[model samples]
Target chain A: MTATLTRQAPQHAPDAAATLAASTPSWSRRAKNRAASAAVVAAVALTAVPLALVIWAAVERGSARLDLTLFTHSMRGVVGQGGGLLHALTGTLIITGATAIISIPLGLAAAIYLTEYAGGNKLAAITRRAVDIMVSIPSIVAGLAAYALFSLILGPGTRSGLAGAVALAMIMIPVVVRSSEEVLRLVPADLREAGLALGSPRWRVIRKIVLPTALPGLTAGAVLGVARVIGETAPLLLVAGFTDAMNYNLADGRMATLPVFIYTQWSSKGLDTAAYDQRAWAGALVLMAVVVVLQLAARALPPQIAKLRRNR
Target chain B: MMAAASAVALVLVGVLVFLAVNGGPAVTAGEGELPAHAKNFLALAGPLAFGSLWVAVIALALASLPAVGVALAATIYAPSPRFGRFLGAVLDLLAAVPSVVFGLWGLMVLAPAVVPGYEWAHAHLGWLPFFSGEPSVTGRTVLTAGMVVAVMILPIMAAICRESFALTPPALIEAAYALGATRWEMVRAAVLPVARSGIVAGGMLGLGRALGETMAVAMVLSATPSLISFNVISAENPSTIAAFIASTFPESTGAEVSALIGLGLVLFAISLVVSLVGRRIAKQGGLR
Candidate 1:
């Protein structure tokens, strides 16, 4: 009778508790999956907030002060309002241009040597490590190094746009080398072998075939380096002493850049100073625009150049 | 070609030598007023070094949580491939945003916005030493600077972790699913285990950045050049090495300059060691 009752109970409750047990695990799993998804969504949104806030604040505050004079006139003696970022803009262009001129060739050459000649040797490893270390050096330290180097050579308190450029170049070189090296490594080994088999010297092959193939990527890397250093404030703060007047010469005299201009405007102002604050916002906006445009160009150039080559 | 490569090595050596030579005086004999007599020479390096470590630690801890989540979202939880790609681009853009711009925003916008929250923390969580201070209205506390650093490093950490997560073996994930595992379970059993080392390396890399970040910290922190203090929310400025160099270098003369350089050298060494270790770990984790 006990055995018969047990068998009967199993048959009666098979679709009730048994089925519930089978579905409970899946229910909990589904709930866990939903919670994880929600957590990811929350994370993405939270991470995006700062970027959105910065862009929004820049646009809102910057647009109020945007005008022709703000771009055309120099802030020579303007105390609280009026004038523009003309000197700062010109100085930024000159300093950044000088930095690019200094960094690109040296960086490209280092990259070529690392990729073509070094070939896992101890020197190559050391060079690679040095580049890595350089990549992480603080911009302010780079500024100090440039300051010390220039000050010692040209007497103390010597501030020049050239010194600032040197400091920026110090920061940019490692970036250029690393990025260019990565691109160079991506060039197919088979292509190198074929070029060698065709009786071209190694240098000629690298110069003609590898470099041309890597030109777009190399440009991208150089542009990335420029983008990285163009907005640096601390190095410029130490090396390029602030100048309100327009200074075309990079070798002598203090000059101003957008970053430094913004910093001075913001920091030098006393409490409740609206005009300087407004100018700072406008300068920040312009700087952000420049950086964003360069970044877009960097991203777009490689693909466009590749397409052009394919068409040719 | 080899000469060019060696030039980079030479530059590295030159920088180190320059710092050592210039900063040597200050490091050996500290006798200068840091903030026009608020502190003496001996007080400079210790406080700044401690401040750097303190802020960087807090920033790293704060950033890692959201960074890991974002990486997971982009890699494993995105609604579609295109969405993931879009999210990746956004993160890249965030990474590309200038540090100074971040500083400006932190000082102008974020500082004011967080005043209430800081006050609330000070009021309610005062029992915790980290929150035990009278909150300032300006919001330029060490905690605020740390949050700014956290924001700055988030994209970097996220990008690295996302790349690692994307490289997780699909076969393992599929096997987990085949064993009747849920999506979260599949990630737990396969993805997390595979990407753990990469995530840690990425966090360390971010920490390296946080350690050396200058303008943002300089702008946001009130920067009291004092000895180490646990009071994070107070108006007492916590001076960091990079920030100290930047703010003081302009007006500093003589041994003061040397001392700032000394502080810079210390910062450089710390960041170098951190980045080297991070790079090694990242390389070992199979990231190029």
Candidate 2:
């Protein structure tokens, strides 16, 4: 090692001398570094290309013959004329909202049990593992499972928006549980200790202290879950029967969702093909926009809340 | 608390049980009703499943390469905080985009652009079995699907890797630099090993998504042929299990629906097992 170091030190001096000599002309190093940096930037830009393409396509397909009726009117047979995505929009909202309602409380309760009450008990660990596994189960399988159960229970020929909600609920639960657990865990032991020291009960500490601290993350998780479930078509395809007209009832009959509408239009025949395609694009664009807006809101909330907390 | 946890566990188990009892009977009935069709379908399914997995592995590899590179660049070589933030926001948007949107774009734009390249491959590599399918309208081959899968999974792998890199204490990096390690060497020896498990976890997470993805696969693949081929340009549809169930289930009547449900059950069973294993491996960090 010494011998190698001795040899390297002499070489380093010569290299330093050359660098010093070349340092007078800054253009060469700067150019090289710039080129290298540009390459990295180019690579990152390539990643954005697909996204650019999607945005471009959405705009092109959605706005070429865009109109208000596409959002205002239902998917009635209006010949070649465009109709608004009321059916799909309504279905997506109803199903996703229902899923959120069902999953949030269940996941929150489970997280509370795991983090606050269960500690490291064998059951808690097992539940944690189960939650982890559940998160990985593909949304499609959840849909299928929902189909198997719902169909079996309801009858041979049964499809409803409620089934879609159930399928989405399955997908949402794991994500909410995992995200909520992480957030709850992030609540410092000190905070919990302080709460305990104040003689507050465990449930009170969790409900008041930990949940508020974790609220931002929990909200973010829920928004993400909504985003995920909103685009889901496979499960909806299996469980939620496709409908052309607006259907408010989730418990019975068919309902249309943006995703399933897209799939149906693309797969089915020329029933105002271009118009249907436009609606599909519009639906997708709106869905993506909603998700982006929600995510931004979720991201912005923490800083805004933190600032508010500081001001108080 | 235990009871609630048990409830969560039971929900998952219930899903499996439902599939088993329902799908199992359907599969058995299928063997009797349409044995030949079932055999053909299974033959098709086996290869397609493996092909899909292969596509996923390749896609993951491609996705991880640039993702890791960009992540490293953002962390180490970024010129300024503004640049870093911009890069981060871009990635966030990329991650946030819905999968259906990706599928739609893939079908409309990427597929068309890809078709010509695929034609070239077909013209050149006509001798290959896999590449022997009819020319698709676009480059909607397994390769493209794989590439799309890579893109879809990039954010996840990159995020995990980036976090792991960030977690490596700056002190360790300085120590390596002081010891005369190059930037690349420092990353390899210090950052890479430390983050290896996290990276795998991220990759597995992405793999899970790829295996189970519905819209993307449904939109992208032609999915007509039961025969598997090595040809990348073949227009033959490479169907995934998810695609099969989605397309068939709605139209299925009586036992036919049950049969489709059975196929879905198989898919669920496979995915559930894979996901469970993925979680275990990720938690153990042994794969690193």
Candidate 3:
């Protein structure tokens, strides 16, 4: 490097020029640098291309039908041009709520066990591997497992919103456990030891000191877990039989969900194809909005809360 | 705690046992109007498995190239920290978008938009096996599904890559500059080498996702269980196993349900191999 710089130095006055080593970059090198920077920028642009395209398409196509009817009426009667995803929106809320109920408790318990109790034991080892495997299990396979279990229990063919919730819970469990485990591990051992030194029970120490400290993180993990599976289609399609009519009861009857609604509306479009397609697009738009909000909240809210606490 | 751990472990065992017990009959599944040369479960599963792996590999190639660039642009080439933050936000939103929406966009918009290119390739490069067949009139093909999966998995790959690149030691970067290296040269010496395992790990994560993705692929390729072809743009394209199950399981009755379960079993096995191998590599790379 020095040799090239010295060679490129000016030599007009040989006596005074002791190989002044400040060398100007070649034009080719500068051009290459500029081109490389541009290429990197272009690559980032390409990464953004899909998000831009998907949003643009959804907004342009679904905008006409994106109205309040999405939450007002079901798609039971109206067919030609006016129908809403009332059942779907409600179904999404119900099933996702149930999924959270089942998953958060189980996942939190497992995470607590792994981090607070289990210290490289056999059951912990098995659970860790299971969680890892669960993370990779395909959504459809998870759906099928729920399907098989339900079939074995409730006759040959049974589909319910509850079953769908079970399927989603299976998918959400690993996510919840993983994130919660990380948060739990971050709790200072000193706090737990301090609690023990104060003559408190282990469970009391955990519930009083540890859980409160980790509550914000746990909420973020659980909310993110819900967001992750809220738009799931394949699993719900298998377990939650779709219906256009309102079926509020998730115990036994079929339930509609946003993703499956979009799928059904688009694939089973009747004579008024444009109308069905429009409804599907509308459904997609709403689902995207909900998911985007949840995701942003989970990632964005925790830091701000921490900042506020620090300021206070 | 013990109960919770046992519950998870039980579910894992149960899924495997259920698939195994129910799926055994799939091997000799001959009750339906079996397509010629597809008398058994292995034959039935061949095309779907091939399609699954083939589409995933294509998506891996397509997403990884741009993902590396995104990482570089964010960490090294960003003109400002704000640019990197905005880029990260955009990617998080991209990941937040569900796969079904991607499917809708791919089928409704991307496929049609690219039909002309598919036709051009078919007409011009017909001698090549990939473009040898007639273009799909509706534009739902393996390649289209691959493109959709690529877009769906891109955010994950890029995020992982960015995280890996961010961990490169500052001293290493300064040394490259001290040696009078150009910015690109510094990256080549200090960044890429350190992040190579991470890049591979990120690619593998995306691969695992693409392999398992159902809705995007299903919504694009109208399932053709019997046909097997490599012509990516043709009307006839191999469909992934997940797509096959999603299409078939809903309406299946009698023995066909068992066959579908067998397909799920095959998928579970495939995913098991992929997940284990991927997790090992990712651990080596040391970034999620």
Candidate 4:
């Protein structure tokens, strides 16, 4: 009778208890997971709130105060009409253009050599390691390095737009080289082999085949590099001294870039803090807009480049 | 070929030469305005760099939790495909936003918004060292700086973790499911263990960026504080090496400027070592 009772109990009570225990762990786990999820959602919300507030502030303050004089006239000590940032804008474009010119060819060549020609040799590996080191060097160090070199050549107290561009170019090279190499390596060996099989030389195969296929990725890297250098403030401040009126010549006296201008406006505490603050915000917005444009351009590249590649 | 290599070599030489000539003499001497009655280099010890790095570490660690969470949720739960895509794009755009803009936002928006909360914390939690202080002049404090740094680093960390989750071999996930393992069980047992390394790597990179960033820190922090005071709401300005460089380079005189440059060098060396180590760990599949 005892055995019979035990068997009956095993079938009913044991099954229920086992089920409850098995399900218990999951229920508790579910509760923990929900809490974790809520915490993350809260954190992300926290991050986003401040960012949204900033954009709102910029729009509110900017619209209320921005005018043509901010863009057209130089800061002429007028009550409200400190002319345009025309000079600053010009200085920024010219200096950045110079940086691109200096960095792109050198970086692209370095990338091509590393990815296509070196075949992962010891030398290539060392070069890659050096590039990695260079990437982490602070922007200010690059500026100081540039300042060191340019000051020796031009004598003490020599700060020029060219000096800043050169400093920026140093920073730009490692980024471009690393990104371009990665993108170029992503082009399958088959494409290159196919080109070589046609009796094309290695250089020709690279130019005619690999480069075209990887153009979109390479362009994206370049866009990122451009964005990185354009926003750099410390290096520019160290190398390019500020000027009220923008000088277009990179090799000559003070040229004002947007970053430096913003720094000066914020730090100098000149009369009319509002105007200076507005200019700074406007400058930042313009810089961000440029980055957005570059990203859009980068995103647009694959389709256009793919079509071109196919035609070739 | 030799000429090309030499040209590259020349650029490197120029860089070294320039820094030496302009920055050498200054490093050997005391730079910046020294505190009165402070005699030696050791006396120059202020809480500035310590404060900056402390804030950075705290912020990144705090920020990483949410970042990893979102990545996990988006990956494991299979959030609606559209929502996933939207969040991914938004995060990427956030990553692309410049640091200076983040600083500007902190100054104009976050500072004012947090003032009331800061006051409340000071009123209630005044005994706690972290919350004890007169509210800052502009509400720009260690907390605001940390938040900005956290925001700047979040997208990269999230992306790294998300990729790690994606790469969790489907076969393992399937096997866990077959054993009647729930979604959470499978993730805990199979997914996270496989992806731990990637997450750490992502976190390290974020930390490195936080440490080296100049503009945002300069714009957001009160640059006047010279000590390692932990009070986030202190009226005193806290300074970091990067901010110190940006704000003082133009106006510094004699040894003061050189010392700042030395600090810049130190900052550079720190970032370099971090990146190299981070890269190795990343290669080993340790960090996301």
Candidate 5:
């Protein structure tokens, strides 16, 4: 859903008269226009100010002690002086990688079903609507859903990185579906028609022609889906309780994530409160860096890849 | 493919079904470890649900005017199209930042930053029940949480409104201008008429988000298990269901966990209703 920044509506109607009127407007109309513009600009400032502040805070506070040690040592049983987020870094990567693994294919298949086979089918529409609604469901609900499902299957108190990954996957799936559907819809119908004319079956056409044509966009969409979920603290904190030590096994005991690490570091303060605060800020900084990079890639890569395809 | 689509469909149902299946025992037992204020399920849920909706209402109210202003700036008021798109992207950055960061910022930076303002409001508007209490010494109040959620949802509402606003027929705008309408009047006649449903739908969606939002409220508000906060700036603020569940679920045992599940299910139901209605409105408005 955060992919929307890159995927705005395709239709941009250029209105020439709009430019001309502003230049030669009547005095009263010009004054009114100026006032309204000023108000809207103020609103934009109001919204942007908070973002600038948060990013500034994250960068300023986080860079103080961000060093090799943060990535080298796990914060296992150390009070403050010597510790790192090796455990959290591995845990977040593993869980999110697993989340992507699980959600991407299921989402791709659902997108293909909706685009190629379902057509205007009623069940398809309901299914599509369901997916759309699911996009806005609370992230915590996903955590609860995963928690309930796993607890039922594994009995009470089943906490694992796998459960956390599953929770994140639940959130990511709908996002992947929505973005994949958007990109899939952009494939030229004539391409599919040509494939069909070449005696290929429908599935063959989708697999060969449609998928290749929309490959870059699909990748971008998947990346954006991951970006959306990577910083999720609520769900992971819910299903995968935090641990200080390194735990690589998905089905093993509680695992730490960067976001949850940031949360826990602040809440469970130690004797050295400043150390904990610095760790939290550094974690936030690292997490923000990853999210921003993924976001930029999601926005920038598709067009470049499309251009490459075109040049080829 | 069918199975994949069904998986998506199933998850939507599974969220509700699991909440019901796991939480049913708690409701049947109807007497377990709940918050100090709650004697039964309804007592536990009623105030929490109300608090959640009320806080979201405050947030929506706070956000709607500025959100529309943002949509208008991006769609009709920008000097150039490039500027509008840039502004939109900047807004999206707000959405991309995780809520935990916002929570930490709220608790650390924003809460203290607004203490003087809260004291001023409490001093001036002390006669009003809603502003009567001595301002929270720590500045972590329902009002502060509302401000945080308002900022969080502003972009969502603005994005939806920007989509619909951009779709306003250029011909309609030109026609209004041709009829000698002032800039504000033209926007009122053309853009507002076209994007009204979008504004309403966006508000509902934002409300849905604000209601279910957990981290900011959990980390910011100094809330207790109480009836709804009549005085939003008071330290004795009410906890939202989502925040309550987040704080409670970590250590909860047997019936208590089930009760938290029940609370979450109630949250699910309320937010589900809001989002479904939002979807219905968006469909009616023909927003994608």
Candidate 6:
């Protein structure tokens, strides 16, 4: 069917070609085309300039303090320059892991129900709108929500990795649901039909056929969610609070994420304080690296996993 | 499955209810130890809300032109489709660059880079209220913060606009060409009409981000805690609701905390309405 459509596609093309050939291009047309091309070039250049400057500036300044200590040592006792981001890095990983644990299943389940079961019901429509609204909730607002909820339950001055994870989870869930729904919608209907035709129940078909096919996309979506919340500073500032020393506990004590660490370093530093600024730049670089790596993995991993599955 | 789906709805309602209940006092009784000269919570809120609006509007205006250009360059005016794809990827990467990093850049690089231009604006454009005041010594004015927010939203706006432009029917474009239209004319006549809804939706989404943006604005603007001024170059600039919440939440207690939360609720409501409207428009335009 696609072959016939492709073969017939060119049948109407000659009329356009004839029209193009008959109309001789005018000077004004050429000038407008030139102007348009210039506009596009200028736009591309303008957009590229800021990005280039950011990456360049990050690498140039961030690398000055990007030593081995940055990955290994914690900024516990060091006053000026010699400490590292080990504490913040570990806290970020733990908090992000907790967020993943909490959000992934909920997001996937929501996506599945929306795509497979809801079927244009009012409930699904409301859930979809809720998700859309959730997507736009500011990171700081999420922080406030988490803070209010946790402070009410745990009492005021409550700051922990768990609270931060919950805040991140709030932001991540909508992203995961939206992206997973898109991926699930892309799965062809015939596959579901085939499974159902074999006398499989709806749940079995979705579980056995649909979920696995969409697994790679789901993973990508989850990773995208992680990439988003991992850099969030405001929410973590409100929920996690800031800690100079390392604290591995999620529920008990304050934790330092890379973003908040950077924030404190810059904001709390005294005038003409170079070392603290250096540390902040290094932390920013590391945070950027983590996000870029996740994005790259998101793009690369799905195809490789598909290839491996095919081979197996 | 049903439980999980309902959780999203529950959280949405929960957040709003929590904010309303906790922040209710500030709205009704003005219970907080108000910022140094403020008479009430409403007085404090008035400036912050307007500041958020003013900066976001400025950011949207500054971002939209470059965003549209980049989107058009990537879709309609690219020398090659592959190059366009590359440009799209670059923009995506830019979007992934965290707000904190942008904040750091705004503080360290852009603030200084814009000093000379800011000085020129203050010196020459002083007749206008928006550019009237002396540029701040540190260059941490609302204008600088607005520019930083503009950079942050550019990628989002461009990506959305590019998707809509790319979806313009090939036949329509060809028809324009056949009618002896120039490339710019083709885009203006064929692409813009089809992409108009998406463009507006994208602009609103960018506006939402600009409004809610906290870390970058907090870092860039030397926030004036309780004052509102229209002077873009002034050191005495108003704080945005999100920035105010972030900066004050750590130190707030009781009524002050409630006031901060009240400000947050306002930010939440504004962003929610803007995003919902944007999403609806995008949906109507067949964009997911």
Best by TM-score: 6
Tens digit of per-residue lDDT, candidate 3, span A140-167: 9989888888887886678999999999
lDDT of 1: 0.87
Note the residue pairs that clash in candidate 5. none
Candidate 4 chain A, run of 10 with poorest lDDT = A75-84
Of the two candidates 3 and 4, the one with more favorable lDDT, higher being better, is: 3
Recovery fraction of native interface contacts for candidate 1: 0.68
For model 6, the DockQ equals: 0.76
Q: What is the C-alpha DockQ of each candidate?
A: 0.67, 0.52, 0.70, 0.40, 0.62, 0.76
A best-first ranking of the candidates according to their DockQ comes to 6, 3, 1, 5, 2, 4
lDDT of 5 at B271: 92
lDDT of 5 by residue, A1-312 (tens): 766864574454587567655557688877987888788878998899998999999989988869999999999878976688889999999999999999999999999999989989876987887887787778888888888988999998789999999899888999999889988988878888989998999999988888988998999999989998999988888899999999989998899999999999888899899999988989999998998899888888678556745664
Q: Residues A153-258, candidate 4, lDDT per residue (tens digit)?
A: 7865688999999999988988888888878877877788888998999999988888878888888889878877887787888888888875878899888887
lDDT of candidate 1 over A194-251, digit per residue (tens): 9999999999999888898888889998988999999999999998989889999999
Candidate 5 residue spans exceeding 4 A from truth? A1-32, A304-312, B35-37
Q: RMSDs, each prediction? A: 6.5, 5.1, 4.3, 6.5, 5.8, 3.3
Instruction: Indicate which candidate wins on DockQ.
Output: 6
In candidate 3, stretches whose alpha carbon ends up further than 4 angstroms from where it belongs are: A1-29, A304-312, B31-37
> How well does chain B match by TM-score in each candidate?
0.95, 0.84, 0.93, 0.85, 0.96, 0.95
Ten-residue stretch with the least lDDT total in model 1 chain B: B30-39
Flag regions of model 2 displaced more than 4 Å.
Answer: A1-39, A304-312, B1-3, B30-36, B40-44, B124-134, B179-182, B284-288
- Model 1 regions lying over 4 Å from their true place: A1-24, A270-272, A304-312, B33-42
Q: Is the docking of candidate 5 incorrect, acceptable, medium or high quality?
A: medium
Q: Write the per-residue lDDT of candidate 6 for residues B1-288, one digit (tens) a residue.
A: 888899988989988887787777777644336543467877888889999998999899989989999999888888899988798778878889889999999989998888888889988888998888677777888889999899899999999999999899998998998687888889999999999999999999999999999999999999887778888878788889998888888887777777788888989999988988888899888887
Best-performing candidate as measured by lDDT: 6
Q: Pairing residues by index, what is the TM-score of model 2?
A: 0.88
Q: Model 6, residue A95: what's the lDDT?
A: 98
Model 6, span A1-312: residue lDDT tens: 986775564455658777756686788888888887887788788788988998888899889999999999988877876889999999999999999999999999999999999999888998998998898999999888888888789887789999999999989999999999988986778889999999999999999989888788888889989998899999999989998889999998899999999999898885548988989999999999999999887876567445734554
